[model samples]
Target: MLADTKKVGGFLLLAAALLLNGCKEEKAEVGAAAPALAAYDLQGNPASLEKWQGKHVYLNFWASNCGGCLVEMPVLEKLSKEFGDSIVVVGINTDKEEMNIQALLDERQVSFPNVRDQLAITQERYQVIGTPTAFLIDPQGKLTGQYIGMLHEPELKAIFEKSRQKG
Candidate 1:
C-alpha cells in the first residue's frame, strides 16, 4: 500500500507540472518581435504583421459588441487617414461570426484593414483581456506600447512621437 501511494503521488505531481507548462502565459513584451500569426482581413485577403514591415503599426484588438470598441472604430479610421501610408492601423476583430463583423464594419465605415480573429489566436498571443486593447509596433516591428483600454488621438500621437525618437 505504501509503494502504491508513493507512485500515485509522483504521478499527480508530474501531471500538475505538465498542466502548468501548457498554460504558459503569453504577452507581447516591449522590444520583442510581434507574433507572426496569420489571419484574413475583411476583404478575405491573408493578413499578417509581416505585411506591415518597416512601418509603424497600431494593432487594436476589439469585438463588434464591445461598447468601447464601437466608439474607437472611427477614431482608428481617422488615425489611418491622417497617418496615410506612413503608419498602419490594423484592427483585430474578435467577433465569432464573420457576418456580424461585416455588418458592424458596414455600419461604422471603418476603413482600416480589420483582420478576423475568429479563433482568438492573435488575441491570446497579445494577452488581450478586453476590447480596444492597442499595441504600438515600431518600424523595426518591436512592440513599443500596450494599451488595454480606449485610446484617443492625442495619446496615439504621443506614442508615435515617442516611437520616432526611439527608432
Candidate 2:
C-alpha cells in the first residue's frame, strides 16, 4: 500500500511540473536581457546586437517568402534612417536562399543592415515562431517589447513611445 501511495505521489508531482511548464509562453521574456546575435551581414560583414549596446535596437526577424515581412522592410528601413543615432535597426533574414533575399533587398532598394539566419539559430534563440516578429530592445539590451505580425510606422512609433513612457 505504501509503495502504491509513493507512486501516486510521484505521479502527482510530475503532473504539477508539467502544468507549470505548460503555462509558460513560448516567446522571449520581456524585460529580460536580449540575446546577443552574432552573425554575418549580407555583405559578409560581421554584425551583432552587441555592437549596438548604446542605442535602442529594433531587431526584426523576417523571411523572403512572407508578404507581410516584405511590406515592413521598407518601413523599417525608412524609420531606421529617420531615427538615426538614437536607434539602430537590424534585420535577421531567415530565408535559406540568399538569392531570394538579395533579390528582394535589391528590388526594394533597402540599405538597412541585415544578416541571414541560415541555420535558424537566431530564430530559436529569440523564440521566433513566425516571420515579421520584432523585438524592441533598449539601449542596455533589455527586451522592451515583442510584436508579432506586420508592423507599420505608426504602431512602431507607439511602441517606442510606450517604452519611453515606461522606462
Candidate 3:
C-alpha cells in the first residue's frame, strides 16, 4: 500500500511539471531573430515586418483605449520622421474596429505606418504584456530591446545608440 502511494505521488509531480512547462509563454529575446508580423493596415493594405528588412524598426503595440498608447503615438511619429529612411516606426493597433483606429490616428495626425491586430495574434507573437509595449529590431532583423509602458524620445535614442554599438 505504501509503494502504491509513493508511485501515485511521483506521477502527480510529473504531471504538474508537464502542465507548468506547457503553460510557459515564449517571448522573443534580444539578439534573436524577430518574429514575423503579418497583418493589414487600417486601409486594408498588406503590412508586414518583413517589408522594412534593411532598416532599424521601432515596432510598437498599442490600443486606442490605452492612455499611454495614445500619448506615445505622436512620439512614435516624431521618431519615424526624425529617423527618415534609417529607422521605420510601425504601430500595431490591437483594436477590434477599423473606424476607431482610424479616428484616433486622424485625431493624432499620425503619419507613420500602422497595422491592425484585431485578434491580437501579432501581440501574442511578440508576447506583449501591455498596451504600450514596444520592440526594437536592428537593421539585421534581430531584436534589441523590449519596452513595456510609455516610451519617450530620450529613452529610445539611448536604446538606439546602445543597439548600434552592439551591432
lDDT of each: 0.78, 0.79, 0.79
lDDT of 2 at 124: 72
Model 1 stretches with alpha carbons more than 4 Å out: 1-27, 161-167
**How well does candidate 2 score on lDDT at residue 5?**
100
Estimate candidate 2's alpha-carbon lDDT, on a 0 to 1 scale.
0.79
TM-score order of candidates, best first?
Answer: 1, 3, 2
RMSD over all Cα atoms, model 2: 8.6
Q: What TM-score should be assigned to candidate 2?
A: 0.75
- The residue-level lDDT of candidate 1 at 129 comes to 86
How close is each model in CA RMSD to the real structure? 5.9, 8.6, 7.8
Q: lDDT by residue for model 2 over 1-167, one digit each (tens)?
A: 99999999999999987864554333467889887664578777767777777778888998878899988888888887777657777889988744567777888988877898776656777888999999989988898888999988899877655655544
Q: What does candidate 3 score on TM? A: 0.76
